[model samples]
Structures are given as C-alpha cells and as structure tokens.
Target: MNVWREDLLTRLSAAHSATEVFSVIEREGKALGFDHLAYGVRFRYPLSNPRIVLLNNYPEQWQTLYAERGYVKIDPIVMRGMVSQIPIVWSEHYSRASNTFWEEARQFGIAHGWSQSATDCRGLQSLVSFVRGAEYLGSAELTANGARLSFLAHAGHEYMCHQLARDHHAQDSGELTTREIEVLRWTAEGKTAGEISILMGISDRTVNFHAANAMAKLNCANKTATAVKAAILGLLD
Candidate 1:
C-alpha cells in the first residue's frame, strides 16, 4: 500500500471526530489526482447523516444543483454503493442503470470517470465518491487502484464514526429508528423528500412522514429549521 493509504488507516484508527476524518479524505483526494471527493453517512444517529464536505475544485454550480435538486436519489453511483460493501467504479454503475439525471450530471461536469466505495462503520453505512475528468479508466489501472480506494473508504468511515461517538457534544436528544435517522440525516444534508425516498428505496410520502416525525421531535417549524437544529445539537458536523 502507498504511504498515504497507510497514513489514512492510522488516522481512521485514531480520529476522534467526523471533521478530522473529513479532512483526511479531502487531503487524500488532492493527493490522488482526483478533482473532488465526498463522503456521506446513513445511520440512526443524528450525527450519522449524509453530510458532505468538499475537497475543493468541484464547481459551485454543480454543488448547488446537487443539493437543490436532491440528486442523491437519482445518483445510481451512490445508490449502488449503499447496497454493497465494495469499491466500485462509476462506469460500472452507468452500465447497469440509465436515468435522465445521469445526463444532467454529465452537463454539470460530474460524469465520465469516477470511482466509489461503500463502508459499513459499525451499524452505519456510507459512500465515498471520487471524480476525475475523463470517460473511462483502463482495466489495468482499475485493478491496481481498486484496493487502495476501498482502503480509503473504509478508513474514512471508521475515522468519522469514531469521532462522532467520542464527542459528547455530537449527541442529540431522542433516539430514532434506523430508517428515520437515515431520512433525517439526508434531509439535514439538504436532500429533498423525493430524493431521500429514492435513495432509501421508499416512497416520497414515506420520506415526508419521516421528516415530519423528525421535525416534531426536534420541535422545529420546517425542514430547514430542523436541519439547523440538527447541526446545533451536534447531530451533524
């Protein structure tokens, strides 16, 4: 393994907060020649939500659209990773699914070449996505780097979860079910009900129901406010 990969493993083992793990992933993306990186968690805990911290270089417009349109639902790459605990390349997902959103993603400079991995951190799961400015990668290159990417994803999730667990401030009031937590976390990450529904394999109505329940428990007026409260309560970082 590369020195950076080893370093990431060590960091994951030692990280005491989500912010610290995010930093390591951001740094790794820059070192690995990728243009962008994002890690999002789906779990019952308030802090275990689909929070994404950019590594720089991703276009502002793309980010805005991604959040505004709730693209996570239609993002096959993310969906595929969530269901499986394995490293994957973007092209593999594209080959299996077709959606209008994928075309839209291309227009936003997010298509073509990418790789991703899924990690199960304790009972929570997350995906780490990486994008490059190309259409494809050779089998040889993919073979050589696949394991490394998996390592990064595993370490990143471990580090983030460890940090969230250790930081007392990260805890929130009222425990939630796994599905409810997943919905709330994605909502806090700015995903729309429709988007969350798609990502979680549920209906839009179901997504809204979960959000409403979460809002009531959190004593918030709206989704936006609920998200803010989640952040303040250290449910997200």
Candidate 2:
C-alpha cells in the first residue's frame, strides 16, 4: 500500500473529531503529490448555499474565477457525481462535450488524473476530488492509477463519515426516525422536497415533514444550517 494511503487509514482510525479527520485528509492529499484536494457539500435547494472545504493548492485567483463565474452551476462532473452512488474518474467525464470545467481546467495545468467520489450522508451530498497537474496525470498514467485513486477516495469519504459520527456520539438530540434521517441526508444534497419525494416514492408533504422534524431536532435556523450542523454532528452519515 502507498504510504499516504496507510497514513490516511491510520489517521481515520484514530480520529475523534471532524477537524482532525479533515486535517488528515489535507495531509494525505499533500502526501499523494496532488495539487489540491476539495471536499464540498452541495445542498438541494438553490436557496441553500453549498459548503466547501479546500485542502491545499487551490489558487485564490482560480477560486475566485470558479465561484464568480458560476462554474459549479454548469459543471457536468459535479452534476453527474451528485446523482451517482459510485466513484467517477475525471478523465472519462472530461470527454463529454458538455463538460464545462474541462476548458478552464486545461488552462490551469490541471492534470487529467482528477477523480471524484460522492456519498449521500443523510441527504447532504459530499464529494471529494483529487486533482493533479497536467504533466503528472497524463491519460495513460491516470488509467494505471485509477483503481488506487478510487480506493483512496472511498476511504476518505468513509473516514469523514466515521469522524462525523464520533463527534455526535455523545449528543442527545431527539431520536430521528430512519426516514427522517434519509430526508435530511437528501436535503443536505440540495434536493428539492419534490425531487426527494419522487426519489423516495413518498409525498412531498411527507418529505417536508421529515425535514421539519430533523431541523427541529438539530435546532437549526434553516435547511442549510441544519445540514451543516448534521455534518458536524455526524448525523448525516
């Protein structure tokens, strides 16, 4: 196993807090020789802003451009990943003509080695992306390392979930029914109540009910805050 992978596993095993786990993930990205690592949580509703965590190597200029340009709205990789339960290699998605991020990414010397894996934890969608430089992550090289990257990405998500759970283990909020947890998880992912209702094969009103109950238990001001607090408490995972 790669030393970075081993280190990641060790840190995750020992992590008692979300901060500690995220710190380890940052270090793991650095150790893997990537330009940066980003983990973001996208909410279902447009009104709810997404939450982001940057690891290392995202330039301020690039960050500004990415956000100011509304790139996320048109980012095909993100859109696809949100609906997928499995991992996706960035290189494969880059081939699509509709992938808006590709042009901008190439200009940034971003490697083709990028890959993302997503998990739905209590309605919040968490995605972790590993990005490298163009020279470092050529097509051929990416093909060779794809499996390993997938493993690492999945491990990273699992680590986050474990840490989140540990953080909330001692808290005594009102017990949320399984359906409520499911609704909150999707709500965190930026899903509309109607969309969630369709996905769960339930009524929109039922979806709203679960969300309302979850928010009350979490004592959050709104859906976005509730999602964030749920993540912090490890309730989503």
lDDT of each: 0.67, 0.67
Per-residue C-alpha lDDT of model 1 across residues 131-227, encoded as one tens digit per residue = 7665466688767766766677777766765565455323345655667678878887789888888899999999888778877777777887777
lDDT of 2 at 226: 72
lDDT of 2 by residue, 1-237 (tens): 688567668878897766676677666666656766776654332235534444335667777788888887776667777778565666666666344567766667554545565655444456777776654456675666666667667776776755554444434367778998888788888898899999999999998888888888867777767766766556667
Each prediction's Cα RMSD?
Answer: 12.6, 9.3
Top model by TM-score, which number?
1
Candidate 2: where are CA atoms >4 Å away? Answer: 2-7, 16-19, 43-56, 95-103, 136-140, 162-217, 220-237
Model 1: how far is 92 from its true place, Å?
Answer: 2.1
| TM-score of each prediction | 0.59, 0.57
